[model samples]
Target chain A: MTRIAEKFVEEFYNSFTSEVLTAADPAEVVDRYYAAEAVQIADGIEIDRDKLIAHLRPVRKNLVSWRYEVHEAVREQEQLAARFTIHAQLRKGRMLSTEVHLFAEFAPDGRLRRATQLTRDVTPQTPQDVTPQTTEAAPQ
Target chain B: MTSRELRVLGMTCAHCVNFVTEELEHLPGATAVTVDLPTGTVTITSDQDLGLPQLQAAIEEAGYDLAD
Candidate 1:
């Protein structure tokens, strides 16, 4: 439905870390937003909802700040796709910034049933052999 | 929406693009982030003027420089 659009995705991202990570009972946030059968895929790793919750249980201990800013967002029927950036800072001065493309499938009840995220580290270009940028035209 | 483009250096991939994009997204009223890799340009959509110092700081945080 129309509810599965940009606004819904924004609400989810906004609530995720701020609500879930900081909460004494993080499971409450997960249960509110994710379906019981939800699956999450990221960085070649996949986990069910329970596992995901368990993994994030320690998120707040090392966290300074984390924010997700939605970039391009699109939706069709029950599916939502977005390209975004995540800025994360840890307590010991470990900082991470990355680009993420995420797609989610919503359950009939409007909670996310499945989600897949693709992330790439924000690193300077690696050194590589390159072709010349310009073709030197011989005098005709 | 209207956009402002910053000619930049040190970005070469989608991850690089997102670096600048995300930095600008942290600015107040910033709405969207777009990067044109071939041109070495990043465009920001925002309702308020993200002053040069702000943009410069963001770019610096990403380990790059904003061209004048």
Candidate 2:
């Protein structure tokens, strides 16, 4: 990626968490990343930016800190496909983390016209050891 | 009434999973939505009253497809 593209990615990640997710005025920050018709998906719910911000407004009030990391990024034409994680720290040492996919498309004027964000809970699974049972009557 | 399994084109990690999950969560009467990254399966449960076409379009807007 070019230096400008790399810088754009870095700045977006920073603003996304601090200015957008954890901003004192979240609605304004959210409007920055999303277009009027942007779609937001969280906790098995989908809504347009207007309704989404309304829902998130309440949630943001309880959140003390929030951060997200983009582990992988691929650029296709004007679209960027990123795989990232969202981690939030609550007031009482409670931490909530989730994974998501972000698709950001830029308009001709260099503004974000559409963004589709998908999120899922992260649950670590334990590896299980499976062994087939042998019948007692089976011949050796 | 119909359930569509969407295979997001740009989704390859947990972040993708979360993004997709968040989108589906907005669907009306969505009982359950699970995004499995390794398998790339977006499983959704609804009351069968929502519009499938609209849902598919929403996924497509994210630059993803509704896989068969």
Error of 2 at A17 (Å): 3.3
- Per candidate, native contacts kept equal 0.00, 0.00
The TM-score of candidate 1 is 0.55
What lDDT tens digits, residue by residue, belong to model 2 across residues A7-123? Answer: 465456555545544457767866666667665544334557666555454344334565555577776667877777656544333355667676778655444655667776663
DockQ of each: 0.02, 0.03
Q: How does the DockQ of candidate 2 come out? A: 0.03
Model 1 misplacement above 4 A: A1-7, A123-140, B1-68
For candidate 1 chain B, which ten residues in a row score worst on lDDT? B10-19
Compose the digit string of candidate 2's lDDT tens values, residues B1-68.
45556565445444445455666766777877887665567878788756668778756544456766
List the candidate 2 regions with Cα displacement exceeding 4 Å. A2-10, A21-24, A41-44, A123-140, B1-68
iRMS per model, in Å, is 11.8, 12.2
